[model samples]
Target: MGVQFGSFDSICETAALVICSLVGTAQGIEPSCYSRNVEVGGTIIFQPSTSFVHIVAIIMTAIMIFHIRSKYTAVGRKEIVMFFYMYIVIELLAMFLDSNIIPTANSSYPWFAAIYTGLVAAAYCCLLINGFVGFQFAEDGTPLSLWFMRIACLVVFGVSFFISIATFKGFAGFSYSKPIGLWIIYILWPIICAAVYVVSQLVLVFRTLEDRWPLGDIIFGAAFYTVGNVLLFAFSVTICDAIKHYIDGLFFFTLCMLLSVMMVYKYWDSITREDLEFSVGSKAAVWEVKDPLLSTGLDYSEEDTVSNYHGGGVAPSLVGGVSGQQLYQKGGMGGRGYPPSDRY
Candidate 1:
């Protein structure tokens, strides 16, 4: 049954690919500026490379949903889940923009891109938040450094957001052949986010050195994304002739989502750890029994019960030399009020 489903999914994916290829061909992606070439009349063209990115986005989005629903968690994880939400939004917007264009100077493609920029910015914001929360929250506290990093990211985002709004950097097509200042506006957030992720990862490595196994998976996956983003940024800026950059898996975003999905899967509870003993404990306890893995909250009553059960037993008079029946006889220790026995 599972194999059948897998085959079915493969078939569906292939069908999707065929459809996308047709769409791209129909739109003249080969000569379209969206594919890195200018049309004769300046009509923006969608490229096959860009189409592949859309395919990747769709696949990863499906995988993300599977991971989230498998847990069946009904509450919390708002920030962590929000990261994926924004991820889907940004990816879909990229795909959606691929099929659209500013046919005229006054067309709405530019506006569409502008609105999408904010959503993408917000998505990257969640990614930063997840990075900090994943480590510090595991230890059951947020350090001053994490808080500082968060505040700094917000400031950067705010400044970048304003600049982008004023310049429509959200349109973000280097093919548009805009001036250098405007290009910087489009690339600002990616540079800043990648820088922050790399630094945050270093901090995580130091903080999690003691944890020998599980953290490695998350660390490596996140590193892949950070490094990929840096490389992608470089590639996008310098390698205009290469069509591979637009292909979904070849670009930074492919690395971003691929590694991110891995990290999310490996460390399924990045935001809140149910095993963190600090999250749940008795507040009114006079003392605490602390441990790295758990806490007892000085539960003396339970301790006493345990101790009593182990160290004590039934009454000697009732069970040892004297039986209950003999004890309850006339003139005995547990006797009725009657004539005394001669031995007593």
Candidate 2:
């Protein structure tokens, strides 16, 4: 049964490849320029490199869904939800295009592409947002430096969004032809965003060295995401030229998978630790006996004792086996219950 479904999926994928190839051939453009690779009849239809990426994306989508449904913290939950939402949108848009519901050959397709691209763009933006939120609400607390990083990320996204819009307009004007202006908008803008994010994250990692916190996770996770985006942008540029585009897409997909796994593990560990501590502490208190007789005549003369038990006066009988003499000397024999002379 599993094999049959798998075979069916492969056939559907091959059909999608055939359709894309036909569309590209009819439109006088390489189908490889559109995405990763193409496959036909259990063989390479256009480019084989892209096939692996599509496969990984399909697998990762399932894993992401699992993570989203499981227990997660507020930040983890938000990031997973955003990521899943973006992917869902992208998948739906892709299906729409593949089904010929939206014309990818005409000028209208560019608009459709741009809209779908914008949706895909949100995947990275949401990740950046998650990193910022994590840094802001870290165990130690929100720091000014983290806030600055968050703002910097926002600026980068804003600029990238603007450039993406311009790029889409250029594409709409030109039917998938290569243009320097288009390259600047599509390629350079994404590169800049990646570079800024990477550098900013590196700076944060170095600056917070002395701080006792989970700085490593933040730095490494951000670095993975940044590098992945950079590679993806490059892949988008060279997708038309060679099979390398598919390989690059595979790399980017793998990077995203790693990032998601890291986040899930990190937060899961934190949640588990917190639960463990609470469980142990609760159980410890549950077995505690509140014997007022054992505490009697104990001299809590030390300032630490008063400070420790400031909530209420310690019951003298709670002490195990101390004499009145010791109690008086320790100054715990106060005027509350026992008189001064009575102590001797």
Candidate 3:
């Protein structure tokens, strides 16, 4: 949740920065006043306070790569692979755009903004795919709520893609700024994704509790992610434009670090621990005894057996032997014959 929130806040901060810059530019005022200026080899660039966002993004990409490589199962491995490839492609695109490697009409440098926007759309698409696969493989296997979330992500990805394409095609036009559409992409999409993640976590928590499984790791991890994202959102909304970018970057970087650490710690024992076993219902009983004692003998009738035992006139002793003295003292057994030795 923290990561989601942080990412959201970071995106919001980026949006706000871009909007402020656009508004300042429109008003014939310098947007650099709200940004930090840096000189690289005599060339000037306005470095937004949110530059740290890129740094954090790099760290997150690394962590995701590690996660993908470390994961063991086929599902986990596939998830990691998808995430890794998608993130790497997106990151590379972003770098190319940021570095201005592509040439533009006004400057000999490349139009990195168009490339960056396209990469963002691609990244979101990958995220959507990952979420879909994850929901499918979940223990419940496609619950209604999960299906809804998956569809919502897909719709968001589609919208983002169209917007990116428009921005890329109209790169030279004044109205081609993708930042305007990004307002929706960065602000709304993160919130939706975070909500889905939280709901999924809740489901897992309840399921684990029902099964009497340890939930400490899942609970803690989810709580961290959730809280981080919430803080990022709140900070982005409240901070002044001058400082919002820096704050946003800080929040994102911190969240990524924390999540990476927690995930590593939580899964460290995965190799040594027993594989989790999930069953739909109750287990069958297993009897160990080879033979069980029964009161009835084979081919015997209860009534007949009782009558035979009584008709023999066998005097009941203290321990199932004949005892004439005791039988006589109690009452004659209807003058039944008994040997002298039976007196004892």
Candidate 4:
């Protein structure tokens, strides 16, 4: 029975592939350009320009992680940091994949592609989840919020990975030749996630915040993300041909994506202020200002102390020559180190 079911599934996949190919052709869908190769010191590199951009992006993401860590008391610091970490992983894998470090004919190529697809989906999911972190729905940075984002992104990755692998290997009724599932996961899923994230963040900045600078960051992020997709999917071949194979849309796509990610960090940082008292790495500076009115009626003369002492032991005046500045330097006078309200 299992054999029969497998055969039936195979037949269905083949039919689906045929139908999808016809539909795709009718819709004018075609493969994007393959970036040009380069030779440096007799060593060949595939997608050289895009790969270099990916490396730079990875480094930038690492720096972003450091910046995020320094926030220390941002509302969603831990939660958003996860997104950048995943982005770094995706960029590293992209560098490997685009450079043909793992060639298409390699046995592990499909697995790498599957993992890349999954990480992309998970990253977008993380972005979407982060948009809601501002709403205090589950208390950002708490165990509940942090764990929920982690588990949800993990689930997204698993689902995306399974779909991508199944399609690549032509199992579970998924067809590599058609790859409708891949289109859904890779193309439509990101679009959905991005749209939702943008909308949510817009609402947050417009309705919830007093300052509107974050709105600009959000808009710039959306613009960069959109341009990246448009260049990659629509103009890659044209750009490659126009550039004489020296570069391609993939380079611009990667650069734009990096800018988009930076905008995400900018927007997050704009909305969340670091609490200096609890922040790491440096002590916050504190300034003490003496109020002129605080010493309006105070007397520190020894004569006053002796006079008050003779009159049934009233509280002694502050010792003479003990200036208000000296008292302040000594950290005030009361047991709790604050001056009495009636005195200086």
Best candidate per lDDT, number? 4
Worst 10 residues of 2 by lDDT: 1-10
lDDT (0 to 1) per candidate? 0.48, 0.44, 0.43, 0.75
Pairs clashing within candidate 4: none
The best candidate by TM-score is 4
Instruction: Tell me how far candidate 2 lies from the true structure as C-alpha RMSD in angstroms.
Output: 14.2
lDDT of 2 by residue, 1-28 (tens): 1113112222222222222221222342
Query: Which stretches in model 2 have alpha-carbon errors above 4 Å?
Result: 1-49, 72-76, 91-108, 137-185, 196-344
- Writing each residue's lDDT as its tens digit, candidate 1 over 1-344 gives 11131122222122221112211122211211113423546655544455466677668767766556444332224445655766676667666565444331344654555555555666566566666654654431234544554465456456544544444432443222222332343445545764575567556656765554645666676677666654443343333345533442224445465666557556544533453333434355466656844563565655564242455433345346854544565666644524555545
Give RMSD (Å) of candidate 4 vs. truth.
12.5
Model 1, TM vs. native? 0.48
Q: Candidate 3 on 223-336: residue-level lDDT in tens? A: 665666554444544433546433443344344535633443343223123223432223575656545454334454444543435464444566646565545544456554
Give per-residue lDDT, candidate 1, residue 237.
Answer: 31
Q: How well does model 2 score by local distance difference test?
A: 0.44
With a 3 Å backbone cut-off (N, CA, C), the pairs that clash in candidate 1 are: none
What is candidate 4's lDDT per residue for 68-170, written digit by digit as tens? 8988888999999999999999999988877777665567877888898899999999999998999899998789999999999999999999987787677
Report residue 306 deviation for candidate 3 (angstroms). Answer: 65
Instruction: Give per-model TM-scores.
Output: 0.48, 0.43, 0.46, 0.75
- The whole-model C-alpha lDDT of candidate 1 against the native structure comes to 0.48
